[model samples]
Structures are given as structure tokens and as C-alpha cells.
Target chain A: MRNRMNQRQECRLTVGTLTDAMRAQSLLSASAIRSEIVGADGVRERREGCGYALTFSCLQEGQVRRILREAGLRRF
Target chain B: MIYLDHAATSFPKPREVLSEMTRCMRFYGGNPGRGSHSLSLAAAEKVYACRRAVAELVGSRHPERLAFTLNATSAINTVVKGLLRTGDHVLISDMEHNAVLRPVARLAREGRITYTVFPTMLLEEGRSPARITARLARLVRPNTRMLICAHASNVCSASLPLEVLGEFCRKRGILFVVDAAQSLGHLPIDVEEMKIDALCAPGHKGLLGPQGSGFFLLGEGVEAETLIEGGSGYHSLEEEMPAEMPERYEAGTLPTPAIAGLLAGIGEVRRMGIDAIHAHECRLIAHLARRLSYLPEVTLYAPQYQGSVLSFGIAGRSAEEVGLALNRMGFCVRAGFHCSALGHRTLGTDATGTVRVSVGYCTTEAQIDALADAAQRLCRRT
Candidate 1:
């Protein structure tokens, strides 16, 4: 169990908007992948707005990207 | 006062809606999508949920396709000014509100576009859909790029057959845009089924949200230029607006509290079932029309299609006088053109307009009865 947990790594896919990040999170969850939206703090600077991304397991990165691209999200 | 001017704005918003707004302002009054803090995320989630709800209401497969706007008027303006290119020709119904009329007219006057008015009034003359389509077939120029119309008349209850119009636009490769100002929550709308490229509606009237809430639902493959450009809470480094939907159009801070309230309002609407609401309101309209029809002075407009609204005028009395008299009787209704000059012109009541009694989900039969009695009393007094 410890070795498996150590082997797993975290991967992030930046989706640009908080809504899209949440949407990606939903799609991943439906596909049995758990993801978290992180990095949304930039308003204190005010010069640059915040950016968000979906953080999930490295094993699910490829599948997540495919799903998001198919859904016409984060196409760039 | 018994509020019947639902076509203008619904009064006595659902309790859930009110509480949701209050909760938003009280608990998590933070700018949505601006930060990762719990409050901002909470607000963002609320806004996203509202977007999903509205998209579902409009039959959109992608929630991202819907964008929050000031009202149906702003949404209509966004689509008209953003979607149509210079030299494009367009068609609108004879019964359109000024929301559709003014924008189209301004574009025409600026030499950016040309337009024609299709005769929806011909439906009153017993014209079939085929006849209506054929007449529109003649009006469509080579440059005709769009057909914009109201889903239902604001001043009356007449609704255009969206399926037929959608089919007509599809065959001709014209964008089908609808202003669902009066019909969004009152009637069922399926953007995909109707081939509607874009739908604009207010959150206030049928959805029972507060005044500053509205949305635009875009069908698949619909594209438009950004009407306004500012902070989209994303891609701040780039000059051009983001290429994706919602964020692409929403260039400023959204009304989080209003959107949260709108979400609750839509949920309530879903719970009550739109069909049941429509049936209840129509029954009331029918009852009132029946009573008012007995009065020789009352003239009902589009009597066959009183969906959730009924428009009538009293003989030898202006709509204003009748409306004021109804108000004095503790009944609230709308008089004059109701911001629908084209509709009034189509009905040939442009001179004095008509008294428009629009209903909502909460409107009661007793109110309708009292309004009918008020109408009768108005005739007797005159």
C-alpha cells in the first residue's frame, strides 16, 4: 500500500477559467478520476487576475486532456 | 396590490429565491471566480450552478454556452451587434418588442445591415405556416444572414411557431435568434430541437429572479464577436478576449447575489413544472377573457392565442384610462405599448395601444376575477 501510494504522482492541467476548471473536475469525476481546482489567488496584486487549474493524478492526465478537448474545453 | 404586470417584472419572488439571495449576500458575499479563497470559490460555484441551470432550461448541451447579461435587452443587443456582419440582411417579426427593433434599426441606419419585417400579423388572417414561410421566402435576400423574433409577444400572448421558423432558417442557412423575454419560463424551449442558434431571456419575468439578472444561451457552433471587453477573470495577460464562451462575453464582474437568486428561482420553476404553470395561467386568462368578452366595450386581441397574457381595449376609452381605473381598483396591470411599438402597430392599436394583463406562476384566479370585474366596472362607469 505504501509503495503504491509513493508510485502515484500528481499532475495538473490548466483550464484558464474557474468555471472550466470546475467543469473539468466534474467530467473527471464522472470518469472516476478525482481532481481539485487550485491556484486561484491573484486579486491582491490586482495587476494580474487569478488563474485556475484542475489538479489530479498523473495516471489520469492523458485521459483528462482527451476528455476536456473532446468537450471543446481548454482547446488552446 | 395584485401585481399582474409579470411581462414587465414578476413581483413577490419565490421564498427560495429571496432566501438564496439573502444567503449569498450574508454568508459568502465575495466576487466569484476571482480567487481561490473559500468565499470566492463558493460564489463561483453558485454562479456556475446558475449557468448550468439556465443552460438546462434552454436545452443547451453545454453550460458554458450561456453568458450572464443585464437583461434580455442586453442579450439581444449583444447577439445582434456581435453576430451580424456588415451588409448582412435580416428579418424580424411584425410583433417584436423595441429590444429587437431598435438594435436592428440602428444597425440598418448605420449602413452596417439591411432588414425586412416579416408579417407575423398574417397569422391572424388564418394564414398557414406554409403561407408564412412562403412570404418569408420572398423577403429573404441573398445577404440575409439572420431571422430574429420574439418567442412570445410582450403586449399579448401570441407566440410564433419556432419550429417552423427554425426549419425555414436552417434551410436558408440563416441564424435563428429568439428573444424569449415573455416565454422563457412560461413555455418550453429546446434550442437544439428548434434549431435556434441563440436565445435571449430575462431572469426577472418568468424565472422569478430579481431585476438585474438575465442570460444568453448559444446553440452549438454559434459564434459572435465580444460586445464588451474587460477582465474575464482569465487570460489577463492577453489583449484579446478569451476564445471560449461565457468568459469570452462576460468581460466584467457578474452580479453574484442576483445569479444565486436566479439559480433558486430556476430550481423552483423546475419543481413546479413549466407545463402546469402555463396551464394554470392560461386557465385564468381564459376565464377573464370570457367575462370581459360579455362586455360590449372590451375588444380582446389574439383571443385564440392567449398563452399567459391577455390584451384588450375598451370601446370609446383609451387603454390608459382603463388601466388607471384597474389600478385604482387595487389591481396592477400595464397600459400603452408596453415597449412593443411594432407589436402595437401590427395589431393596429398603435394609436392607443391596449391594456395588457400578463400572468405569473403565483397569480391567482381571484385576481383574474377581480380584474374582469374591474374591467366591467370600468365600462359601466364610462
Candidate 2:
């Protein structure tokens, strides 16, 4: 279950739940977009009471965000 | 051990089931849907994959609508308690397990609703879908909000015609719920084709998964009150679980290792096709039934139905005695009511509580022959 993830990636999408992260991850995977879900410990990951983010190495930020939004993912 | 108690829970699970569970505990033992680390997400993905696999196997298009629960009993409680309301009436089959009966009975005891026992053609000479539907039609009332029944009896081979009952419920605007405890992996189920409002099944039995894994799959247009409320990994900002399908019902962290085992179990079942598994078990039951029928002391119930389970008793020895004797002789069989009072009463085994022998996909002809010979010896002693 080992995966290569860029922890310092610039493109990161923060989601509400683990299920949402999984959904967004699956959608992005199907679209040939590689992303990794990590603990949302970043300042941007802070919410009222949540902490799970999906990180991406994509240069095209718009497309990744678009896929996340299209999949109805609740993001920060 | 010659385990024949599959109706209780499958034993000697496939190597894949055992290996996957060990892998999950070792590699990704995080709480599913509870965390966001690599191990957590990996576990979450495995759980989702299992849901998708189950949905596909049961012909449910909405994998998200399938929620994992402790077992079929908890799922049935969620549905029966969540959906039923005051002034609502329910109809249950005579062969329903306690899972279906208890919740419905509790609701009725609280006087929130009422229920009627609809007879099934367990012993009728010429049973067919038409006859079964006609009998159900006779019991249907305008206030009948739901029809909860088992896909197959837990103690015997009698199974209801789900397609016919589903159509009847749809026509009457009644929710059709099925308890597939004894039939999930052993019989064909199409939630979409059957028009089932809710389908409950245990992963341990026919699916060959370990204990502690089961699922509740909801059909379109079916909504039930949240039976339990807690931290749904998502929507913690709000007090209510989100209106989403799974997150709505799954209030707490899911069982990851058991789900991982279930994923492997489903893989094994798929490797041996559903039809092939069912036919193999039924063939074994048929052979055993044929052999036992020759003994004048033996009486087989629900012999005509083609399924993985069969029930019988010896005239001289009580079911408890026979079950113990079989155990001593290295043949494992379940005796007594099997938690299905309604089923035993309907099948006329309430007094004797027939000894139940449930086969599985891996059960062989040699095992059936051995069990048959043991049964014959028991009969001869009588």
C-alpha cells in the first residue's frame, strides 16, 4: 500500500471527510490526474474541526480544482 | 472439522480472506473514513472497493447507497426502526429470521405499528410465484407500509419469490425489504431487478468473509431515519450526519480488517461464479436429502427447494441429541431453532427443531457422502 506522494506539492485540495477525499481521489485517478491524500495539518487545512487534504503535483491547477468541484467535493 | 454450519457462519475461510485481513492489520490498520493519512486513505479505498464489489454482485447501481453495518441484524434494525412510524402496518413472511422479526416486533410492542404474518408455500404441493403473490395480495392492506421477509429461510431451503413480491410491493406502494442472511452469496439477488427498497446480508456466511462484516443496501426512493448518531468522518461541523447515502447511515468508524476480508471473500465468490457455488451446494444438499429420505426415521423439510441449506430430524432422537451425536462423530451440524422461531413454526419443526446442515461453495461430494453415512448410523441407532 505504499505510494509516492510529494508532501511539499504546491497544488493541494482540502476536503471535509475521508470519504470525500477517497471520492475525489478516485475521480482524479480516472481522469489520469495523480493525487495523494495526507493529513490536513497545513494552515489552509484548518477548519472548525476537520483535517484531511488531497495533494497534487499537477501544474494545471484549474483542471484539478475543476474535477474536485465537479465531483461535488466539499473543499477548503 | 467437516463444518456444515454455514448457515450460522462460514468456517475455514478462503486463503484470500485470511491473507487480506492480515495484510490490512499489518499494512493499513487505520480507522476507515476516520483519518487522512496514507494508511487511512488506503484503508478507506479498500472499504469503498468492497462496497462497490457488493453492489455489483447484488445488482445495485448505487454503490454509495450500500452502508456497512455490524451484520444483517443491525441492518434490519436500522431499516425497521428507521422507516416504520406510528399508524404504519407491516407484513412479514412466516420464515423470517429473528433479525427481521425482533425489530418489527419491538416497534409493534411499543405500539408504533402492527404486523401480519403472511404464509409462504413452504410445504404446498404446487408452489409458484403466482400462488405466492396471490397469497400476499390477500394480506396486503392500504396501511401496509412495508413488507419485510427473508430471501430464504435460515433453518430450511424455503425461499420466497422476491421478484414477484417486489412487484407486488411496488404496485401497492409498499417498501420491500429482504433479509438475505442465508442466501446472499448462495443465491442470485438483483436489488434493481427485484425493486427492493432495502437488502440486508451478512458477509460471514455465504460471502465467506470473517464475522463482524455485513451490509445494508438501499434502493432509490428509500430513506430511513438515522438509527445511530455519532461522528461521521465528514460533516463534523454540523450535528447531523450529512444527507449523503453512506455518510448518513455510517455514523461511526467502520471495521476495516473485516471489510478487507470481505473484499477478498467477494473475490473468491466471483472466481467461483455465483451460479456455480449455489449449484454445487444445492447438489450436495440434494444428494444428502436423497440418502436421508430412504431412512424411515428421517424426515426432510423444505426438500423441494433448491438452495444451500437443508433441515431434517430423526424420529427417535431429538434435534439437540442428534446435533450432539453428529458433533461427536466429527460432523458439524446446527440443531435447535437457529434463531428463527417463525421459520421453525412455519416449517413445522417448532417442536423437534430439526438439525440444520448448510453447505458451502467448497463443500464436496465426499463430505456429503460422509455426512450421509453418519446420519444413517444415527438413524439406525433409533
**Could you tell me the C-alpha RMSD of candidate 1 in Å?**
3.4
Residue pairs in candidate 2 whose N, alpha carbon or C atoms collide under 3 angstroms: none
Output the lDDT of residue B342, model 2.
93
lDDT of 1 by residue, B1-382 (tens): 8999998998889999999999999998888877667888789889998988998887777888899999999999999999999999999999999999999999999999999999885335666778778888999999999999999988778888899999999999999999999998899999988999999999998998999999898887889998899987766777999877888899889999999999999998999999999999899888888989999988998777758889999998999988888888898899998998899888888998899998899999898888888888888877
Q: Grade the docking of candidate 1.
A: acceptable
For residues A1-76, what per-residue lDDT tens digits would candidate 1 score against the true structure? 0001124587655455677766777777889989877663344322332366556787776787788888777442
TM-score values for chain B across all models? 0.98, 0.98
- Candidate 1 clashing pairs? none
What TM-score do all the candidates reach, one by one? 0.94, 0.92
Fnat across every predicted model, in order: 0.47, 0.38
Model 2: per-residue Cα lDDT over A3-63, one tens digit each? 2235564566666555666667777899998877777665545453246766777475678
